[model samples]
Target: MGRRFEEIDWRETPIGAISLRRRLDPALDVDVYEVKLDDEYLMSSLFTVAEVELARLALAELPGADLDVAVGGLGLGHTAAAVLDDRRVRTLTVIEALDEVISWHRRGLLPLASRLTGDPRSRLVRGDFFAAVNDPTGLDPQAPGRRFDAVLVDIDHTPRHVLHPSHAAFYTAAGLHRLASRLRPGGVFALWSDDPPDDRFTGTLAEVFGTVRAHVVTFANHLTGGESANTVYVATHARPAGLA
Candidate 1:
């Protein structure tokens, strides 16, 4: 039998707003927040296959190494939560542009976030991730480094389908170039897209990163309850020649 939707609560945030919805599935005993922009459903917490998979890919690419991870978005904290599961992570910095979303997590609206917030190794910054990345002042007092081991960006629905007009630049060639400069040697940059991106975005990644690969992860049929294919991008920078 399929699960049934239960109750939903609406909440406003400084960035925009979100709707917290509940499901009656005994297996999944929690509420999911749906990020909304002018009544449109932008992202949700119910199904986070792509979000979790992105973290897994980043960790896999940097095995046996203590990692300092920078996460761009904190929607329901699924991706951040997944990243925290890795024991190899030395520190995690989550930069969220929406103050209200941060407030929601602070007030216990998101269980995963609330749990992770208490961890000593995690730091949450309420600001624009782009500016934080580009700023050398260092957003976190504890993390005083120019580069991160992995940078996971989930700031938009996709590269082409940007929910916010300002986010458009982050996917462009120039925007990506700035992002690439923030990564440490051997660092990986991963992004989550609602679907596959256009050739321009992929081409730009190739131009900047040198080594790029895209992985498509399909959710379980029972979970989807329908047919859909989800994709995420994992691009890494190649060490310059003669650098070990």
Candidate 2:
């Protein structure tokens, strides 16, 4: 028999309805939510295989080095938690735009978020990631003069399809050039998408970075007993002096 949804209490924001559901075969509990305008699946606490893989790939590119990692989104804190698992990571700064989402994690409503919050290496910034990345004044001492070793961005469903219109620029050619500037020499930029990236985005990455690779991850559905696939885009910068 198929599983049914049950109510889950949310103390942070009243803009959406939250619920929990159970799957028969896998026999797991999943947290799901429906936002006011977004009818699609916003997020869940189920399987996070792809999210973990994204972190793993980014860390692998920076092997044997202590890394200052910057994460663009903090959904359910799965990716953040995965990134923090690496002892080589010196510091992890997550930029999330939603204050209510931050509250959910800080208040212990989102168990994963709460756990990540306890980690001394983790800090959250409540603002648009694009603006934060482009800030020149270096208002935040932790960010100024610090080029990231790895930037893991999961703010969009797909590279071509962004949830927020304001994020469109970040995936463009010019925008990618700006993003590449934020990376330290030999740094990596990792992006997760629900589908394979469009050619334009891939072309832009090729233009800005020396090495670019794409990988697809497939997993069995925890809820409906089906299969799903997602793609991750990884680009590594070349030594800057070579560019000149």
Candidate 3:
């Protein structure tokens, strides 16, 4: 129906040159949106089960109302939109390292752009997610030291495989401790990974959170003509023993 392939936007960011492209898939008979960081494929609208699940599975761990949530990446706003879907979420702060990606959403370059930018409960912030966790200001800059009910991350490929060297620290126990400090008691932390369930990372999370789970999310893969899977790690911050 449309052009076979079109690059919506391309910008050089601090991390790399990120690009947004839309192409018509003849097999699926639909338009697919994709994001690329330099030569590496970052995300695609064709397969987003895990991205949405990152928010759904994370929020499911918390049984609370009027929840404030933070999302690490704003790639296509899939994960962020999933968070807003739950009516219980009171506020959402999306911390994205690349301002170019945020501009794509605000400029309505993607399908979910309007939904994310129009939503009054959602705020798109230009900041580094991993850096914020390791900072005293925490995730939300406006409210320093502000804690959230849940933190869902979908930035790097996996804990071990990171885009930059700086991200490796956040996967460590010490770094996780810092991340845990940004959450309220009983809050949850979830991450989306391209690889299968990693036991070593689970052990590292166990040291920081009370309960940890590695979820293998499978979705139909049109390109492969089969199913592909991604991992979602959900960890809940333990409440103080005396607290009820």
Candidate 4:
């Protein structure tokens, strides 16, 4: 008999009802896991190319060793896992607003749960990405005013679209400036957007950072057929005059 769909776990977060579900995929002939917030799909193991690239492209921008990084939003831990793959990384702190998401990993309900929790370089932190950015000891409570080599974010669909109303402010000029201050002089900031790049947002980034780039990452979508693309926005905090 075919296995039935299972609701692994769920919680009533400050945002809304969030759930984790597991089901078998007939097409792929494997078990698939999904995360949903209220009526919207937050993430799925089936579609993670963009999440993986979000970490890769961000690290690619910062070419150095012993890098300190903070990844905003830990959906299924794909982005956090990808960041930990680089041997040069000295430390990785994943900031997640939802306590339930962290519990899933700690409870080993997620695929990369063991890998992420066991890794000496990685740690899951319970915090809000938007509010943390503006705080002095936002990313690291132990070390106030501490900065990282790069910050990779994939919380919302786009700047125009956010999980909460409070998040919309972070996409603006004032909010971005505070975020930039948390990075080192040559630090890199990368963002994953569901929609294509917008000039208005790019313009705002340009105002704060020395360099801004939009990367179109194409991946095969088995569900939709053919290929689909997402935008990865990359910016440098007073970048040096050189390429990685």
Best by TM-score: 3
lDDT agreement with native, every candidate = 0.76, 0.75, 0.94, 0.90
67-183 in candidate 2: lDDT tens per residue?
889898887788999999898998888888777667667877555766688988899878778776667632134557568889999887887677767778888877887788788
Per-residue lDDT tens digits for candidate 4, residues 1-244, read 1475889998898889999999998888878899999989988898789889989888988876999999999889998999999888999999999899999999999889998999999988999988889887778877788899999999998999998898999999999999998898799999999998899999999999999999888888889978988899999899556743
**Candidate 4 clashing pairs?**
none
Better candidate number, 1 or 3, judged by TM-score: 3
Clashing pairs in 1: none
TM-score: which is higher, 3 or 4? 3
Q: Which ranges in model 3 have alpha carbons more than 4 Å from their true place?
A: none
Higher-scoring candidate on lDDT, 3 or 4: 3
Taking every candidate in turn, the Cα RMSD to the unseen true structure, in Å, is: 3.4, 4.0, 0.8, 2.1
Residue-wise C-alpha lDDT for candidate 1, range 1-244, written one tens digit per residue = 2345643456665555566654555566554456665577767766688899889987788755578898988878888888889989998988888776677777776668666688777888887887665566543445564588889988777888776777777777788777877787778999988786456778888988868878887776446577555677888877778866
Give residue 178's lDDT in candidate 4 (0 to 100). Answer: 91
Task: TM-score winner between 1 and 4, please give it.
Answer: 4
lDDT score for residue 110 of model 3: 91
Question: Each model's TM-score, in the order given?
Answer: 0.85, 0.84, 0.98, 0.95
Model 3, span 1-244: residue lDDT tens? 5899999888888788989999999998989999999999999999999999999999999896999999999998999999999999999999999889899999998999999999999999999898899888999999999999999999999999999999999999999999999999999999999999999999999999999999999999978889999999999999999976
Q: Model 4 misses residue 99 by how many Å?
A: 0.8
